[model samples]
Target chain A: MPARKSAQPAKPAPDSTRRSEKSRRAIYEAALALVVEVGYPKTTIEGIAARAGVGKQTIYRWWSSKADVLMEAFLDLGEQSLREAGPVPYAFPDSGDLAADVKAVLRATVDQLRDPRFEAPSRALAAEGVVNEHLGRELVAKLMQPSLDLYIGRLRAAQDAGQVRPEIDPRIALEFFISPLAQRWLQHTGPISYEYTDTLVDYALHGLAPR
Target chain B: MPARKSAQPAKPAPDSTRRSEKSRRAIYEAALALVVEVGYPKTTIEGIAARAGVGKQTIYRWWSSKADVLMEAFLDLGEQSLREAGPVPYAFPDSGDLAADVKAVLRATVDQLRDPRFEAPSRALAAEGVVNEHLGRELVAKLMQPSLDLYIGRLRAAQDAGQVRPEIDPRIALEFFISPLAQRWLQHTGPISYEYTDTLVDYALHGLAPR
Candidate 1:
């Protein structure tokens, strides 16, 4: 009877909502820090709960598992970075200039990749994802797909504008601009810089073969 | 003094050499199996020794670290694969058709990547390399660079033959052909197939824009 009553309680006040937001932020921070320090395999929901000073039930009420928590944390971090960058949150700009817009977003991505605060945690998660197929697929679907959709959106705009050829699949065409940079960053295959990415943009847009 | 004398004993007989080869194969198999079973971080020299029916001293005598052992194991696996495929070991064919050569090599890579025997262990090491910068860089230098050099050699041949534009940096240009395929495989971004790779070859050799 008591459990049923608690479950059917009225909505919380604004103050309680504020408190909930604070707990959420704390949980996110705890999850990211734990993953970076102990690695993804060792990070646990209990650890996040203890570190966040929240109950395990509080986390269970919100997310299903540690992977869910970590994925949301990463998404929140990306949003925060975007907000701090002083742009419209999460929109790939379309100023009717496909090349410039892509170059701009990619340059920002290069900055984010090199940022010390983001690099370690991202690397930890990505490393785990590489070997864990289920986690990898989930990360791609939940965290990465949104960003990729933005690229696809922009590419479609380019195609509509007659800037990108209509025959090209936006998904495949987008890889030419992004994957090289990603491969270099993830694998340490080469040095990453705005100049290098800018070159990639030029080559991808203009094509490698003689026009 | 007796131990030193034993260590400096006379040259091995033909039978002893055959036994040594068997031991070497056993060690390589053990190392690969351990890495695939337990992952790179947990797979140690001692564990590999136990699995191989070898002493720690044997591993130490042959290699300095597990990384060295695994790297050599992977190199050996690559060589064996090449030999079994009935191809000349370690050379990218240059038939004076740059596009055909690139396609042929990439197709072979596709087969290698799909092979179940190679995939699991390779993923294990590659996943480790993503987070371990030192190991990642070393992997690139030792294992990947040899293959990359083959691409560079082929591009140079193309330039000489007036098929590829000489002004284009082969290193940067090569990324168009390789990085997209790699990212697809590593990240599960898209499907990989002969038709897709062949399209990459055609698109790369000719500019995307109308001539």
Candidate 2:
């Protein structure tokens, strides 16, 4: 049900594009803040509209549901982080040093996870996704899959470069790098620091078994 | 607050022990079911007492709060799972074949995660823990630490056996094995299966680098 696809026109007028971008950013910020403050079940289209200072019709015009808006909001947040980091969208640096590249990207992720602007809203949405199956699945499909694809792509590159073993599944191997950090951040299981994540990257890539 | 040691006797007489065990089991079932049905915030001592058909005094006689009751309930659940698996209490097996033991334990965990009786109640508590920092910390300290200790103990044994790298931190290395499965289970990020966990164990034990 979340897989609705509507192709937009190849190009829009310059003014229209700018206006649309503005509306989109506003909607994202509003949706994230509302969910953080009032929680998921209580956040609504009307609330997002009112907070964003846009009419209900404008939001309804773009996204079908508040879930859709929040998903896109998160996607935007990732892109914004990338832009701030002075990268072209999202790309795992292929410096040909697999371990260094991974550590660099994970460090960036740690910054994003710790960013006050991102933390509360992300936690709120993530909390809701835990209990709400439909929303949870949609989140995986929209927000998470892209980031996962980047990991897959990087691992594939590593495989080609003979850095990673060919027999290893990129999907599973990637989890060894990210999931530990995620668990610490989400569950307060342990302290997350550069040293901690750097250690995870090393342990994951080099194997816990002896060299 | 979670560290408060109850003044109750560690081991009561046989008659009282039997009576206490019965009351404890009832409280655990009531707490798990109530949290699943109504969630953590709404679940109260009085509610658990009413649902378990036990008096409020019965709950207070052993545990101090609803949080304490829920924590013990999860511990009991883990112990029950261990008993069913034919393990004495709860422990990670050390057969000197680290891979085989880890795989077996992980597979059992996969089964437990998928169990309907375990899933709902655990999710209910976990969902609340995500948003409530105080409760989340308490849950980790009370419920999660014991299982984590088992993992740490096993890793230490592995270190002694030379199955693991001497320099690796057991705490961090354990995350590579446990956190991925946990993230997938808790966040619905991906499918959880025996094959998946086995692969994780293999990846963590062996370096992902070209051997």
Candidate 3:
């Protein structure tokens, strides 16, 4: 769970609950918009509050720092993306055919990356992370680590099935599936497509050298 | 060649040439420092000139814009790094054993990425490129493309030697060598070291699947 989630859940009346939900959504939208517009360094809580039509104290009430707000906002955005992708409780697909399962996940990622709502704010935050080491590590730990864990879990399953080499480090092995696509997307090195991701899966699983 | 390279070579008097060389080195240092300190958007030609103790006209005489100056500065820095690595004419070594050759190149790259002078300025520029599509494309074209080409060439050579599958696209195949390292360096996803990179080579060359 995110560190900022309230330890004691507030039990409020229906009207107050609805109002808080509305305010929270507005804050998320405002934070994402501000980061996309002004970039991360120039984005302030005051600006987010003003844009959200909420008081600064309200933002402080929920989150301790701008980083916290932005991180949570991004997490919300990712959740929204996952929900749009399908039903609740998305798990990394493990159909026993490791290649097909990984390809499906990577295809979904390509779709998420191409989403207009996710692209701009994500690029802004990712760009900041590239230069800001503290923020970069925070992004890795908070934003990316969960997905990485899923990849590692799936790989472990493949290992158990005798589909993957047991001695292989899933951590580094997983990069071949994601990093190329990421470099292409973030650096504008090449076009991203399902076919491209499928190729990554093939190359990573089967090896580039003749089998 | 970079677009800004002079079409005609200038023949200047020896004393004048020495003065120009000194001024050029100062400008390159100033541009890199400004980008690292103030970032790309805030870095101006006036700022670079002021720092370099040169007039704005001196900058305008050689480069059309700040982008040109920065790109040339980075190219110069890369050459300096290559020179420091050893004697000139650094070719991608093809020692029959493709893995050993690629590993050596990647190790040298690790050294370059860890260089104090290269790291900050490179991170600053790469961060800017992530958000700025046009600049990102330019960076890929002018800075990364040559290195990518060398990788492609080496992979092609390996294919000819039957070390790699002839059916594999060299372009995508090469990403397995570089993108993981690039992602780790740019995003702080993992610790970078010769060992980590060597492991990547082994995993990539030999399939992660039990062979």
Candidate 4:
């Protein structure tokens, strides 16, 4: 859940760029707040504008729809999360230990998932996505897919190092590690912790059967 | 999901018991249909009664809340799913090959997930559970926990037979096989298939690392 906010200003006059940035932040904050308060169905662009202290036309000038605004807002929040989480720098750390590296990333993800600021709104959007197929796809494509691609890159690196099986599909194999955590977080199926994630890394890399 | 439905008859008089059974079946069908049509929030006892061609008094006479009614209805649907699928009953097949057995069951689950009768209403209830924490816990405790216990039992059996490692937590280990499929169904992250599930079984048991 990392953000690459793409709310680019068409032309950046210095003062105007500062103004646009301010407005963008306000809109992102307001959009997330409204979605949490009213849910996806009732979260309208007008509502976001009202909460953000901007005109609906101001929102329309930037984002095409409520979905676009919320998506970018979430992206911004993810970047904010990365910033707050300190020098992690939003990239998978490769210390040449696949288990240690994956565990580090997952532990950070656990922190991100547990962060109170991210939790409620993330749940609200995720819950909405369960029933709303189109929005769900967008969530995966924009918010989730990037992180997934990163995992794929790291896993491919592991394979080249002869750490992971070369024949394994990183996409599917990655799910063995991430999906369990995702499900527990998403479905209330179980509690998540650093220990749980570390165990997942160990389990994913080693066969469950007797060695 | 297993339903140990508590929709028992107050009186056991022969004709009364027969009538109660008929009403129970009608209520289950009605509740399931209503949820799929209008979702959990809009589905009501009154609406279920109207659809099932029974009295609201009849529904209330058995179940306490819409959540109860729907949970029981789903339990019944699960049982119905079992019967239609085969005469294996609902028990996990203990063929002594843990991989083969789990693969078979997950494949069956994939089929059931795709079934028209189960798909819409299951999605409706699941979507509701995602947002409603109270309902979500009830979903896990009542509907999901029983089925999970079955998996635990099977894994434990595998442990005793030297199939699964003894130190492994069946609970977490089970997630590898189930959560991926659950996430796919809930989030539309990917398509589910027999081959996909079979691979999940294989990857889960064997590990992602090179042998």
- Best by DockQ, which number? 3
lDDT of 3 by residue, A95-192 (tens): 79999999999998999899999999999999999999999999999999999999999999999999999999999999999999999999999999
For A5-100, candidate 4 gives per-residue lDDT tens digits of: 345656669997777778888899999999888888889998999889989888887778888889888988898878776776767778889999
TM-score of chain A, model 1?
Answer: 0.92
Model 4 spans with C-alpha error above 4 angstroms: A1-14, B1-15
lDDT score of residue B15 within candidate 1 = 91
lDDT of 4: 0.87
Question: For residue B194, what is the lDDT in candidate 1?
Answer: 86
Candidate 1, residue B128: lDDT: 88
Per-residue lDDT tens digits for candidate 1, residues A80-152, read 8878888566689899988789899999999999888789889988888888878888888987888889999
In candidate 1, list every pair of residues with a backbone clash.
Answer: none
Error of 1 at A157 (Å): 2.2
lDDT of 3 by residue, B1-211 (tens): 2325454246768887787789899999999999999999999999999999999888887889898899999999999989887795768988899999999999999999999999999999999999999999999998999999999999999999999998899999899999999999999999999999999899888878888
Candidate that scores best on lDDT:
3
lDDT of 3 at A36: 95
TM-score of chain A of each: 0.92, 0.88, 0.95, 0.93
**Model 3: docking quality category:** high
**How well does model 2 score by local distance difference test?**
0.85
What TM-score does candidate 1 get on C-alpha atoms?
0.93
How would the docking of model 1 be graded?
medium
Given the true complex, what DockQ would model 4 score?
0.78
Q: What shift in Å separates residue B78 of candidate 2 from its native position after superposition?
A: 2.4
